[model samples]
Target chain A: MTNFVQLILNLLIFPGGLFAVALGLFLMGIDRKIAARLQRRVGPPVYQPFIDLVKLTRKEMVVPGTAHLQAFWLAPLLGFAGMMAAVTLIPIAGVYQGFKYSGDLLVLLYLLALPAIALMIGGSASSSPFGAVGFSREMVMMMSYELPLLVVLVTIALKVGLATGGIATFSLSEIVQFQLENGALLFDYTMLPALLAFLVFIPGNMGVVPFDIPEAETEIVEGPILEYSGTGLALFKLMTSLKMIVVLGLAIALFFPTPLGKNFLVNLLWFFLKCLVLMVIAITIVRTSTGRVRMDQAFKFYLRYPTVLALISLVLTLLQR
Target chain B: MKKLLQKIAKKSPWLYRINAGSCNGCDVELATTACIPRYDVERLGCKYCGSPKHADIVLITGPLTARVKEKVLRLYDEIPDPKVTVAIGVCPISGGVFRDSYAISGPIDNFIPVDVNVPGCPPRPQAIIDGIVEAIKIWETRL
Candidate 1:
């Protein structure tokens, strides 16, 4: 009973729900501010995303007459719920131990695909031509990125499993525990390719520039989300921010789950700082410096580069064993 | 609580642009206003959104021509309620150089209620920014 209550609290109050949302929005705000500065412009305040969400709630929601109302309404909630669940599964080094399950990493792998699936469902259900186009592009992007991500996860799992005298361990806690006993995989020369592949995966999964083909504003006018307004739009924004936390948090856990000190609050802040640094390196800088790529080009790029990079790590991990 | 939300909401006003078949001059200026660091509208918490549904302020450029009058009106209607419309360039107001042309159908106020007018053949970026500021004020009242 106590465990159930703790799980609920973790999912709703701390580390997963409220805390994750706030941190995600803050990271997004910082990304925008830094991007603007990169372009020599004065950006919106760091709290701009929070204000935008507030404004979205006040506006009227316009549902397209042609849209499939059920799917259109349910898509955002599906993605949001998935992220909420995924966040609880992530261990926060010294602060939180995460959900203790043997195959939590595999569950996370499946959960990570939920938002893209939500996007595809929403786009197709919208009944707009641009939405149709977006749906196809989004599916292709997902397929292209998923292969590399699967390889990367397997590589890490195998590396840890072999080192700890097993075949493969899909438990996130075990991965963190191994790292704590030894050191972070981030410093491991063999894992560098996987790390780099994960970095590339960040922007693609987050749907930023060079990989924002599915929601290309210029060509498709925001595509799948074009028809969403008011509260529906706000939900989508919240989902994206939550996704930021999940992806960044997952990256931190997998590669470098090191805590600063023994204090819980200090470790929590340190984790946030790491997320911020990772966001800037992987998402912000890449987005600011690059332009959008064609959907086919992006598909080809992901397949050729990150897949090969992750595969190299997989091979190296196997060879090391 | 509603009042507090409104006050906070007033800070963000995503802008959407509609072209009513005017010459590309004003469109270029709008682009400059968005792209150039000198007249950064983002500082005002204004984002140039691609979809009308996401817009809080509609920036309509071009003289409404017979070709695009229906399309422009439809686009304007697509924007959710409590939106402020800012007519950019004299073309939207008097149809500018196209006023007497048979192809022109504007003086856009006839079709859509324009809340602010920045009058010029092609208004400078600063004037456009000023017009957007005025639109934001009008938008706040509606919220």
Candidate 2:
């Protein structure tokens, strides 16, 4: 009887890997549709992302005569692997696929860095002037955003530490469990600054609007992926979709309350509802706002504003204790 | 039967704009017309098609300058037919600022029988939206 129960638990966890890919793709589709609707135009169907990937995968690889074909090939694969590793680390629906460590938050952050770094290296190796300029901008963008993001993570962890009697839990699963037991962070007055940090982090993490300087379509011709085509392009696109889902999951885990469900499907539904609301808000702001600041302006804003907010939240976390 | 379905599917007229030589004033208004709490073009079932072949209406802006003329014509020809062309902005309609320049090829209508002409130095978003709506009505009438 115990063996049968263990087998059932294994079945439940294995499907989550596949589910992460599907959920990621779906969130991306909705982001496009919502962004389009916000612009007052009908956007592509949600399935349009899938169609694009399929088409790109079938297309022949184009290698520019002057470009490093090897780096270009490896970049997308590294990006995809990094994101998959992050997803596997996240304990979604209380089911993790194999690797779940107490120090997984550190692993998750480093894994998240891989996609952008891969793009930077790949773009710089392209030997095109446009690619070089784009890679330079991407490097500056990474520097600016990651500082505020790290500060925000520390602030949240600080709050969780206070609530749980100074245990210093960095595991995402523990953080969510804390919220489930003591109500969501949004309900706590001490967490208001952290909430604001979350609001900034959402768009900044996705590299959309006000912060999308790296891929500003008008200024840069599609940015870091400008030289990419065929399967390479498809992998980059897939990483984008997966990245959105991962960020949304983090937001849901951090701020929103997860309701108790009688079954696995019901719990998944509840989790998705919290995630979808967070996603819609992020995408809507991107679509409605049309200000693309210079790289310096973007750098100044994130460092001064969100980074400061995260610091204040950390202080507040202490006082609330 | 698949071909017929594709043809029917093509008629509702999804458009994508490409600015070859025009001032960006037109692109600004075009973006605004499609944003929320405004005209809400999504309700119309028309979309901003990303590629030319997927689009039924190719909205061309700006005068035909020499450097961009080849690229523009190639993009225009790439659109699969049962398609309509709309000359947007006074520049594309009558070569506004660029007329009589050595680089220009004159009004867009000279090369393509424009299904619609939206006239303005750089037309207002509403005017552009209205022109596309009118084009759709004409398409429905033909159907």
Q: Any idea how many clashes model 1 has?
A: 0
Candidate 1, position A319, lDDT:
93
Segments in model 2 whose C-alpha atoms lie over 4 Å from true places: A1-17, A58-60, A94-99, A162-167, B1-143
Q: Which stretches of candidate 1 lie over 4 Å from their true place?
A: none
In angstroms, how far off is B31's CA in candidate 1?
A: 0.9
Colliding residue pairs in candidate 2: A38-B36, A39-B34, A39-B35, A40-B34, A40-B35
Per-prediction DockQ comes to: 0.89, 0.12
In model 1, residue pairs whose N, Cα or C atoms come closer than 3 Å (at least 3 residues apart or on different chains), thus clashing, are none
Indicate the residue-level lDDT of A9 in model 2. 45
Task: State each model's CA lDDT, in order.
Answer: 0.91, 0.70
